[model samples]
Target: MNTTPQQNTQDRPARLTVGVVGAGRVGPALAAALQLAGHRPVAVSGVSEASVRRAAALLPDVPLVTPAQVLKAADLVLLTVPDDALPALVEGLAETGAIRPGQLLVHTSGRYGTKVLDPALRAGALPLALHPAMTFTGTSVDVQRLAGCSFGVTAPEELRLAAEALVIEMGGEPEWIAEESRPLYHAALALGANHLVTLVAQSMELLRTAGVEAPDRMLGPLLGAALDNALRSGDAALTGPVARGDAGTVAVHVSELRKHAPEALPGYIAMARMTADRALAHGLLKPELAEDLLVVLADGANGTHGTDGADGTDGANGTDGAPR
Candidate 1:
């Protein structure tokens, strides 16, 4: 993938003084990418000794220091800690009065906005959230993948330009998202990216049970094509038995799942219901057909139909015979 050239000149001179907290997957990756983009990573710190060592190996000459030292010496502080630890870290930094006014504090957590850094913000430092929409598996492959990725950025209006400038400096497109919408936006990414991994693992397990020698080999082509199609055309890429509303095929699938893969029944039904909803949204299925498909999946979930008024007649599929 091609990336825009790093913006550095005598006038601009690429802000090279960076401090990174948390030497986990994203921290090291970001540090490496920043170095490649002409930024200087001056100080690095993490809770785990192994993580610290890993980060040290990446930036061999950079100083390893405490979080407080990082805040004092670096113009840009990157907090790549775990999501749950973020607020506490910021609060701790604030209590110590370590954050200086006008300093840039950024985090790489996908699920949060600058709100998690409220303490730092209160201390007069600029808070920025820059989350890349790609997975980082702590491998050399990630270095290549970072190029051309999209980064969701959220910051105070006063600091928005600087946040966007940093994102572009790292060879990523800066996508602005409202602070209030951060959770829902992150939820969409989790559902579409993270949960897809679980779904694929489950599929591979089922394929293994069915005697496929190499499930990944079998799935690679099919999934790759599906992903490509979805990327190119969005919902218009829908296909397979559910997209076609093949009730008979779905029934057979439920039956087989019950016998050979009872563990997968719940996921299959839930995803089928979701697909029915999407099909309805796309105008691919008539209201009645979509409702019927949902009912079939829900009925399987409860092990019976027409009992407890849970026959999926509650419009869960969003096909109430009204205009979409």
Candidate 2:
């Protein structure tokens, strides 16, 4: 791994003794990568059966010990605990006088930057946030998958070179994340990746309710294509009744969803309404068509606009039908 630019090629340490503070899904995978990079994974801390298994499998023979012992044994410590647990863990460790001056303390929480490690920093340990922008499965295979991922790095200006090198050695690119933007960056990822999973699962369940054979298999290509198109074409990839302004088809859709899958009806209507809004905003749907689609979605399968304007339910009697 490359060293700090301030250090001529020769002044840098050849390797660091790394301690893993938690052998969760992220910790062992990172330790394995650092091991492959020639760093020593000296010790790890874990309590759960799964955590123990993962550490043994990925960092074999690396001592599984108490958190204090792990900290004492290493020059670089990686804290991979849950986001909520980290601040307390650091503060507790620092309070016990486990953290030391000149040691590197790093955390892998996407939602936080080095600021959360204030306890360690106060104790004179250098702090760094090196969050890999990818999920982990707590397997050795995850180490291999790190090759193309971006790590959202937040480090003290003086310690940046060391942090970047560590990230690079673990087979990731370091994308500098400012301290204040960590939350927004993390939010975007959750909205896209996590929500996509929920949306897809909802679709799969709906297909099962429709009595489709092997619904997952059936959805694979269609969902894949839709995702690819959406990514490649942005708002232009929108399709279906909302985009086409087929109020009649959308009204029928609401009727069927309400009849067969009442749970999914609200979600369907919400998505349809949002899609129509986006389609209009992006100029993909003409104003007249957008108005009609919005009315139908707002009023539901009654096949009528609710009288009022955008809300369609402001106070309108449901007598006006969608434009024929």
Candidate 3:
């Protein structure tokens, strides 16, 4: 990742003095990214042991101070606190008269826009919402990942250029998001990224139950291709039993899930129903076959078609071994 320019560093002066109000995984990583772009990380605030370690490792030599002190010291302050804590934090900082005139106040909350920093703005702070659309590992690797990452940017119309420039300086692409659309924007990202982790974990657990030695190795290329196809083709990438309207296969899957992994059954049925709906709407599932598939899914939802108290060996070779 080409985070730093090839030009001589001794010539260009550092852009701004950066401070992190919360030394969580995202805070340090972002501060480190800004440091790579010729910004100085002067102060950070961390409470937990992990957060302190992250700050020490990522922002070496930077002083660990209070949140108020962070705002008092740095030109650019990153409010990387949890979503629920953001409002009170900003309000408290502004109430304490910590915000300086013309100071840059940036936050990394996906669910919020610049509106959350209204108090700071009133205190003469320039509010900017720059939420990076990537998971952070609280390591130097995250700084490199910022090179090609996309930042969901929300700021005042007058400060649009400044927000975009800051994102660019941190080696990120700026994606403009309206203030009113921030919640929906965050919901979309969470639905895809966060839920995908749960789905992958459930799949791995099911594979392990089915005697797969290395589930990650088994899912690596298959999931990679599936994700690539879904990204490239959208709804047209619908495949598997739901897309093919294989009601019998789906019924067997639900039965096996009920017998082997009852906890994962709900998610499997929910996702299958959703996939069926999309497949039907996208012309992927034939109308004639969809009726039976829908019935199978409805049965799965109602817990009526699966092996409730039977031997749990209905659609296999004597005993339940692996997915057929």
Candidate 4:
């Protein structure tokens, strides 16, 4: 009787040797995850002090070598360099004749799809684009986070199964992204995840400046519930004064931010306008109330509050009028 591929694993080698080109926060964690999936990590290349430390911690005993050496040693080579450096690195590797035929060349860049690896593909290497949606701390914790993280995957049609299988082996869910859609997909993730960090940090700083102690503690539950609600019910989760079309409350907020956190005023006004538009589109903001709210936002945007004094200060409350 002929043995199936699954049963024939005992007769053939099972583990693919993994290599990392950049020992950045993302690379070593991924290599560690692959190690847990029974893959052998043979080599990693990183020049910085931080990279050396991370690689040692995450891939202990895996020899640190050059990028070309990494490609030479492993069956699956992870190109975990920065997005901007990826194209050049691939070209250089292909030019130097480092890439082997049948080698798996995987990159964890959200920006580019498989096209960036065409040079490597022309060298007879297989291309895989697998971008993890989660942030990394350059620690073992990243490995655990992979248990339910989503990976934005793009590959040649013939290699789709192979790409998804690699994602699953690293304990990630595979979310297929079209080659042409990679840029938009990456932009959406950056808009959400990256901007959320900025927003949260700004909110905490504003709270601190407003005489609040333990701002993190105060915002913890509030932000958590807000995030959960927004995730569960998108536009319907719009709340607060902007969503309710409370022109007076919004005006007061703009006045206070102008008085206290002038630097934050622009971002506040921009997000409020966006929120107001979304609320109007969702029918959450009443049309009758939207007119005044939009005017307030417009005034805020133009650095002309409805109640500004001659000094360009929001004179609704008497205080220093500095735009600083």
| Predicted structure with the largest TM-score when compared to the true one | 3
Instruction: Give the per-residue lDDT digits (tens) of candidate 4, residues 1-324.
Output: 986433544455548999999999999999888877778899999999999999999999999999999999999999999999999999999999999999999999999999999999999999999999999999999999999899999999999999999999888999999999999999999999999999999989988988899989988988898899999999999887778766766677788899998898999989989998999999999998889788888998887857433234433224332221
Question: Would you estimate the TM-scores of all the predictions?
Answer: 0.86, 0.85, 0.92, 0.91
lDDT of 1 by residue, 167-208 (tens): 877778899999998899899999899998998999899889
Model 3, CA-based lDDT? 0.88
What's the lDDT for candidate 4?
Answer: 0.89
Off by over 4 Å in 4: 1-14, 307-324
Candidate 3 structure quality by residue, lDDT tens digits, 33-144: 8877788899999999999999999999999999988988999999999999999999999999999999999999999999999999999999999999999889989988
- CA lDDT, candidate 4, residue 282: 92
Best by lDDT: 4
Regions of candidate 3 where Cα sits further than 4 Å from its true position: 1-7, 306-324
- How high is the lDDT of residue 226 in model 1? 89
Give the Å error, residue 117, model 4.
Answer: 0.2
